[model samples]
Target: MKISIYREKLKDKINNKKAKIAVIGLGYVGLPLAVEFAKKGFFVFGIDIDKKKIKALSRGNSYIQDIKRTALSELLSNKLISFSCDYRNIVKSDIIIICVPTPLRKTREPDISYVVEATRKIKDNVKKGQLVILESTTYPGTTEEILLVLFSERGLKVGQDFFLAFSPERVDPGNRVFNTSNITKVVGGVSKNCAYLSKLIYSKIIPQVILVSSSKVAEMTKLLENTFRAVNIALINEIALMCDKLKINIWEVIEAAKTKPFGFMPFYPGPGLGGHCLPVDPLYLSWKSRRHGFEPRLIELASQINSHMPNHVVNKVVELINSKAKHSILEANILIVGVTYKRDICDIRESPSIDIIRMLLEKQANVSYYDPYVSQLPIGKKSLHSIKLTKKNIFGFDCVVIVTDHAKIDYSFILKNSKLIFDTRNVFKKFNNSKVFRL
Candidate 1:
């Protein structure tokens, strides 16, 4: 058979966990996944352009919250994993996985430059009998549009001389329950042989594997997952704004709806959508949708509502400052309790707290923050350090805003010490203090 040469060789290497795997872009998603592959006794080659990351990983120091330093040490001790900045090392690898970022441009269109660049590097070093799978979250046609064409330029036929697949990574930062070993790995490929080889490799580390028909379906699957959450969160955010106008408590409404337990999945409103998937993925889908001559109005509306939340939060603070404080808004002291995008993680990408602080400062309000995970934040030219969350520090502020409710923060202590509070995360739901206001 024509497929016997590449398929059988890959099957044997994967079955023995002897496959030389190369995982690119060691960030939130890439680092943890690379570690998992190492644990399974695979000779994993970790590649990234960041020397700081390579230095840390090479010395067995982990910068990500989810991957532990001890895991790196064990992997390094066994010589199961190696880190490098050079792409030429991939010439000896049997599999290459791309986990690079897919960000948006100033026009809000999908930016696949990172994906293209990674492909170009792979193109230079790509060899026959190597399986290339892209795990970066992108548009539907990206795998075929970029990977296949680039790799084939050097006369390597995909699925014959080399295998090609798209496996969308389902990595949730700080999610303890579903890590790489347990979550379902969704694989789709350009050909059945490509999908089979990809599944054989990923099945060595991940427990459940689902192979779809084509790479586009796998790409669309990942987008649909994030878009679903983005749209629903937007719907609830708009409802929260409606409740603010009607003197209704959105939290209480969500609690009431939770009793039914059927058809109602609660998505809380916040300063806005944060993290990588929710804010960015839907826009990828939307960009593709527009190109196909279809308008995703609801998705666009959701983005608008979620984006407006920080402004709404600022408006509430303005109302409180005018109503409760003797000082003018110019010199009012506003302390932000937490600064990270989500609770318990150091990730600050696309965080709404940044917007809230900027809006506050633009209003000439004094803004300082406290986050155990983040030490300091940059705004324009100046920087704001995480002040000590002491009683004296808490009392000095005119109003304290609970933007992110990290698990480590003492809510009761803050409630007792703050002069006035605007609770965005419902950290004060149990409290009956007259001075505590909730969004």
Candidate 2:
């Protein structure tokens, strides 16, 4: 095999910080990545289908919490970053990344429509020597099975004409300690040259890049990371149920276990697994495994258990309501303290609080929510806004459910005024309040 001229040229562009980069779907993953590259002096084209987001970026507004508006403003003024809804920039870029969403359909099947659409756009305008990488969370073989096939249909050879790789986005929203730049990036390419070029491009922005054998491994690496969390969380969720039955404090048990500091990692139980990855990624693997005649028994069971958590939480709410209000879930003024999947972030893709609210609405409960980070949330035909956490409002709700443990919210105020409290996150540790019922 000979050294490819295209690879060397790409390496030169990356090293010189002169690479023209196109990033599709500028949401949580893409915006941070594009900003990082632009901060590193690469000319980044931030593309998204959402014109609102483009308009926001055009005026130096940031829709993502982790990215600062000042950074975007500085970069835009310096002409290092450009935001648009156009895919025509694809032809002008040396490296193109697809950071689009890979959400599951209503039936819990993998919906790669966003990925397919982004890939199609790339294929329509992809030129020779441009490297394409997918940072979307997807099942193994998606890069080769879907992306490579789509690009090859455009008469582009993988390593020679265009390069392709999968570097799964390890974005933990609201995680201050580790981020898109410092976290180790795992890259797997369709070919050896593809992997090398992919690693090269990411190494320009992200500090650590690890090479895997193939795109399948890189794809599997992401699924495994989330599935591990989902499974362990399911185990802990199930144990929490057991502890509840045994009349034991699960939070206390976790604290005791943490004291060991070895062979024991504590996974807390909550409303359920939420966000983009944990609730959805494992099923993608299980779905693929089933297609390969392999039964991922543990994955299926864990998914079932995690999926039950939101309803379990609702049951806790019902239990609390019944103990006080002398009624069923019907007509109960249940307030959700925080609606986001996790604490202190606005991204609510596949959030369990949504599921809990949906289930509550199904049972005819009057549900309201409050989160400083989220202003409005749309559920079905009705939209719910975050309510004020005043004494009167807190007293109005029959029970308050702390779905997400946001730090800024005055928990003392909630415990002080609320009629009943369902503490899923153990926010009130050892308070021993009669109105506070913990999960």
Candidate 3:
């Protein structure tokens, strides 16, 4: 595989303001990438199959809170960025970056259908001197096994006629500290030239560009980063549970541990791990490892612990409610605070709050939720809408459960108003009263 032409084109694209770039799958990752490239003076085409996303982007309305309206308006007015569902525009572009979702199946298997379908779109419009970089997070060998096999059918050859690389998207939704332009991007190419060009393209936008040996290493780097997070979160969650049994505050322990400053980094305990990347990425690696007759025991164990968090929270809720009064499980008014997967973000994909709400309903608890960012959340058969989080509303609930610890929620107000509080996120650091129970 050779990519001399692709390397030259990439260098030209980096310096040329008119060089066209097409970003496929305009979700959290793609939309931001498109905007950043446009801001850097490149003609960016944002493509997605969903007409709704295209329509919204056309009107300059963004679904992600991280993307400001003023920035999007500037990009739209300059005509540097465009949105479309058409594939013809993709073929017109010099560089195409795939940022589609790679979710898991029911059996926790890697589901690359989105990647496959998007790659097929690229194949249909693929031309010579095209550079295709996949920015989606997936198992190792996905670029080689899934995409390379299909591209070989075109007979154009990778790295020679067309360039290919795998660059994982490190988009942390709602994170104020890191954004597309600042985050260090990792890129690996099929060949040396392919990697060089891949680095050249992203280097224009990002502050630091890290290059690995191969595309597989770049793929595995993403999995390793997410898996480490999953395991550490699991360990902290286990400690929080043990602290409950021993009648100690986990928050204090974490704070004291942070003072060590040498071998310590603090990770908070929550109801469970949620969000698209941390919970889903590990399963991709675990499934892929099986092909080599290897099982990731650590990954599996962490998953089990993370998955069981909702159950642990629900049990604590039940115990707290039962001890309060002789009321039946079906009659208690349960209010769940913070519905989004994490704090301050509207994205609720794989949020453990959904699981907690479902389990509560199954146990016959009358569950109502409150999230400032989210209006309505779909859990099983019911569309649980967010009630106003106020002193009056909090006064009516039998017990308020803290699922997501949004900064907007007044912890003191909640601790004072609710009859009893089940603090799963440990947000109420100052509350020492008997009415508050930490899970």
Candidate 4:
């Protein structure tokens, strides 16, 4: 078939809800996206290497907090969406989206192995006239440099025999307002037809589809968005440290500055930068910049500041314990309020609470955690479970550190019971008490 004819056929299938949409890696990003596509009347297939996730989805259950179980059950019952561990589904898909993770290595460099592995699977099973879109977050030139080479090596001509594009996944896991269907989708392709086909597919489920000039542009767009967040968060964290030394409440200062409403956007300080995006994405940009003979000093510095926050929090805990408790840190019983990276979410990937727990353990402190969302914490070799937050358990601890300010926690109960409270998230700013120490 001619290239134009293939493009027109794919576009028609997308518009008429007849396209088989396959989403690879059904974790935080892929599950919600696959559900949205299926809800819009598209036949969606979800692929994942984790058998546990496959089994759960096959049984019409959702592991992700953002994806409701009822919604997933309805789609599974209607036969609009299916789950699989086999790569054979790629052959039947008209549009395939790769939502695999792009995490950092131990050396803090971009680990594109997951993206590469998923692309290789697509290269093996993909057929002619199929559209492949990379939704994984990575450095610039990934779609063109990595994916384009893979397809070309398989003797497939992109934009002719098959379509190729990059559309960054803008998923905020615990966010209630903006979701997969509401957030604007940004897409770019190696060729105009590739971009157009991707935009058509996303427009069916998304509110808006932004078409960029090229795939590299779309990749850089994601990096810029997260890098902006990382940099500003580091700036605010440093200010909070300064405010602590000067005896000024950083939360009050932020409130005063936020009233301007023109130039300043408030970013609260925390134990550290956590989650899948802020801590990992900026380093991908910095790593790519170093390859081109440019060092991203600001980004590197921001990472350093944010990385030190866990230590800073640990130091404050020690200081408060030394001053208030009759016993040293080694003998003190410490309790952590929340272990997840953010509030109202169960995701603990790259959470700074893990680092804080490790630091406290090294100091020989008796540490326990209470998160309504997370039930267990698996460290290097030991497994810690969440303790029940009773009045006796609350008062028994010498120090209670609020790492993640989850809304569901009883702040009044904590304030009335705990001996000394270290508020890393500034949750007790409104209540002025001698026992509460703000970070």
Q: Which stretches of candidate 2 lie over 4 Å from their true place?
A: 325-328
Best lDDT goes to which candidate?
4
Model 4: lowest-lDDT 10 consecutive positions = 1-10
Model 4, 106-207: lDDT tens digits are 988999999999999989998889999999999999999999999999898888889999999998988889999999999999898899899999999987
TM-score of each: 0.98, 0.97, 0.97, 0.98
Q: lDDT per residue, candidate 3, 1-439, as tens digits? A: 3436656765676677656899999999999999999999999999999999899989999998988888898899999999999988977898899999898889789889999999998999988888889999999999988888888889977777777999998888888899998999999998777788889888889989999999999999999999999999999988988998999989899989999969888988888888889999999999889889998899999999889899999888888788784566686899999988898899999999999999989888889999989999998777988998788999999999999988887888888788988888778767688888877
Candidate 4 wrong stretches, greater than 4 Å: 1-3
Runs of candidate 3 with Cα error greater than 4 angstroms are 1-3
- In model 2, residue pairs whose N, Cα or C atoms come closer than 3 Å (at least 3 residues apart or on different chains), thus clashing, are none
Worst 10 residues of 2 by lDDT: 319-328
Q: Write model 1 residue lDDT over 1-439, tens digit each, in one string.
A: 3565878888898898778999999999899889999998899899999999899899999989888899899999999999999999789899999999999999989989999999999889988889999999999999998888888799988778899999999988878788888989999989888999999888888889999999999999999999999998888889999999999999999999988868989899898988877899999998999999999898898899999999999999999988987667788999998888899889988899999999999999999999999998987788989999999999999999999989899999999898999999999999989989999
Assess the local accuracy of residue 394 in candidate 4 as a C-alpha lDDT between 0 and 100.
97
Clashes of 3: 1
Task: Report lDDT (CA) for all predictions.
Answer: 0.91, 0.91, 0.88, 0.93
Q: How do the residues 328-404 of candidate 2 rate in per-residue lDDT, one tens digit apiece?
A: 88989899988899998987777889999999999999999999989999898889998888999899989999999
Model 1 TM-score, 2 decimals:
0.98
Model 3 score (lDDT): 0.88
- Residue 41 of model 4 has an lDDT of 97
